[model samples]
Target: MADETRATALRVGASEIRADAQAKAEGREAYAADCYPQGLLWAGAVRPGARHGLAHARIRSIDTRMATAMPGVVKVLTARDVPGTNRQGIVHKDMPVLADQKLRYAGDPVALVIAESPEALRAALCRVEVELEPLPAVCDPVAALATNAPRLHEERADNLLGAAEIRRGDGAEALASCDVVVAGEYSTPVQAHGFIETENGVACYAPDGTLTLTLSTQAPFRDRLEIAHALGLPFERIRVIAPCLGGGFGGKDGATVQCLLALAALNSGGRPVKMHWDREENLLAGYRRHACRIEYRLGARHDGTLQALHCRLVYDTGAYAHLGAEVMALGMEHAGGALSHPQCSDRRSVRLHQ
Candidate 1:
């Protein structure tokens, strides 16, 4: 019935042309991902290689001599170049803008290469050498919580990032009095956004020491804060302009090319710098929907009236804590629609527990 109402309402005035349809269809729309300032120096990353593998490892040494000597390669930057916090995240500032001490994921960037052209940037990135030391890694969540499992962050004692609960009425007591009950275990696999435009951005550091950035991002204002905080620059000095995007779909909701590209521009001697991830890079580094495991028990009266609901949900945010806690909270809001299930008392919702 609710679905019918929603569909009916949409049909009345739906099918209206989109605001960006004409510009997009005419190929006249300018996307932040496609922004290119004049005299743009391309920037690329040199990722840690095979010694320690992608699952986990520790950084031993980074050798950028060869890449730095490349004809067009301007500067080879590492953790040494990053100032201020050197960490970036929407909520938790745990993810390193440049991987310094640990390589949490296979996609962790070890170094940034700035060059005069895309060809030079790619060549320089390939020439950069890195050495890694293998460490005991806990790839599985169940194993990660083990007493002896390797700690991803030495500061953190366990792999359990967080937990949550929702509640209403005497949930357990209500379930005990129910006439019908069903319980099940459910799981969902991770799904990628596969956005068409990929991740890309352009940034410029002006002679006046202020910075301006135009990029394909969902939150431009937030990007300004992230860049300012991560790079140790004044927040007011940075201007983030999001022209438009071919597509973002939450993948661009957080920092993607903002901080790193800004770092490149900082050292580009007033020249604009650009960073655009290719298809392969995006798939490995881009954000995706969290895979989840849920245990739910539903109780109801013999008359088909829902009496109570109890559910536990787990969200695997992967290498970084992107919107893990927030996403889980949203799913718990409905508890698979049990909140709308009719109740015997005036109370119409199930409760949540930690």
Candidate 2:
């Protein structure tokens, strides 16, 4: 009987094959990174030579002479070459497209080297020597919030980005009336979105002053706005085309290679420029889920009915505020579990433990 059922299911499935299955099997699907044109320029970012510091890297000497003199070498452009605003970000314009002042993180881009061949681009990036004056780094969030800690952002007092609180039904008063109370602490680890294809894209500037981008992005519509605002280009001048992503899972929800690739394309002189992050580069530089520390307290009646509930959630946003506060807010909202008792005086009280 089981074999008959399986056979019937197979027969039904055969007529309803997925549309993407045939194209994938035949290798006909076109991914964004696969859209390479003739005479394409290769672009790569020069990562920090060291770790954990205020990266005061000066372009005192970029010995690109060897790279330029080499076969199939184009131009090695630094922050000085960026025609518009060299900064890029989603909500907060804190990140620089090319690091001009000091390298904030180890993965900050110091130079954008364009070459006729991928091999030449790699060689040129290696030859670029960036002299950096390292400053003390605040690796820990708690230490970063300390009064005397080195400020990551000079405009802010400490490293505290944001804080929020929610209250309902006099939780403290109701907790006193409860017969039983429970308290505990919990912590969650940082999660990585291991997208299969990694982050990759291709960008090209047309002769008509239009910048076109084909990228692995989830928010292609929103990416246009961010690119225009960051690069100081007209919104109509930028066009973004999103293809079937290898995987996004929220990590690619914001600006990744869109802005940098756009900048590289603009400097490519109408030639298409490609940027593909290998496995290691993606893991090291890609954004991850925010790590969180939570404290929970619950008050209950004698019948195991929930009375008052309170929780404090703290999240390590890490460098930028990439939906960290929203994630914490969602976690706080679910702190009461699934059940709610009317006999209980207090229903919910959740606060962001900044």
Candidate 3:
């Protein structure tokens, strides 16, 4: 009788689970992309073609005549259309909202086009002709540090962005006093955030001249200030609302869709403009973790008492200085553990490899 009861219970449980699963099996779940508005305009960016190079491409001639004449085409704007500062950055104002003079990376934006229909937007994007002058590029950070390397920013010396160091005792002297020592090299690779949603947002300009933005962002509050400053609009004039992000992983901490979408909304004629980054665009244009290389040396007494330590850390900050200095500083702080000896030697040094 007990065996019979157990079998019946198992059969009932399976049926219940099947019933719950059937709804999803028939495609009952709804995602955000499934929703459509009565009137929607699609907005997108025209990224630089090269992976790394000097961006001397000037929009020498925009044949927007054909695009504007196309059915459902709204407006085509360039960097010159930007009325404000035209730059965006978290701690430093370096990145351009729209490349007016030069493109820093291959994925940098050169133009923004808005159209009544997705088909129209696609046609307009293709019709837009850009003339670019290709300059020398620095692919490796170590190569960028060479004395003869091309400068990414004219104001900076070489490609080196910044450096940091920490020292305690006489690390060089302690190494001589120690009987045993170990030297090694280590490296870390770049990691992606891999958020499911990628990066996306919608922007609208109200009749009263207020810009409202709904985006999948991590720092919605800071984004508001950044957008306003870059667009040359009053901070109060912009209202940024963030929803549950698909995934961020610190990649979206700075400008992603905020400035571009805001510029789209400004030229959208009070109509809402939406920008959604596809998987390829997200991968190519997205910010990544700093790749690092470390050289370390440790010395100890014959009896195994730690004596001296020295290290040199090199961080590859990629094209832009996105949290590179801060990341290197953190590495320098953790290079060596706490020590208790009075005459012990410890030193840590960091170099930014562009």
Please provide TM-scores, in order, for all candidate models, with all chains considered together: 0.89, 0.85, 0.84
Q: Write the per-residue lDDT of candidate 1 for residues 169-219, one digit (tens) a residue.
A: 677788889999898988787788888888998889989888998888899
Write the residue-wise lDDT of candidate 2 on 22-105 in tens digits: 887898888886788788888887775343234333334444565557667677777777756776667666777777766556
Strongest candidate by TM-score: 1
Clashes of each: 8, 1, 0
Order of candidates by TM-score, top first? 1, 2, 3
Per-model C-alpha lDDT, please?
0.80, 0.73, 0.77
Candidate 3 residue 112 Cα shift, in angstroms, is: 0.8
Residue clash pairs of candidate 2: 55-103
* Model 1 lDDT-worst window of ten: 345-354
Sorted on lDDT, highest at the top, how do the candidates line up?
Answer: 1, 3, 2
User: Which pairs of residues collide in candidate 3?
Assistant: none
- How far does residue 142 in candidate 1 sit from its true spot (Å)? 3.1
Q: Compared with the true structure, what per-residue lDDT tens digits does model 3 show for residues 1-354?
A: 999976886884364345436654676643333334557788878775543244433434445566667777788778889978998887767788877766667778878888887777877777666667775777666787899987767777778888666777778888888899899998888888888877888888999889988888888889888898899988888888775456688888889888999999999878888888888888878888888888889999889988888888888887677677887788888777765466665656555545
**Candidate 1's TM-score:** 0.89
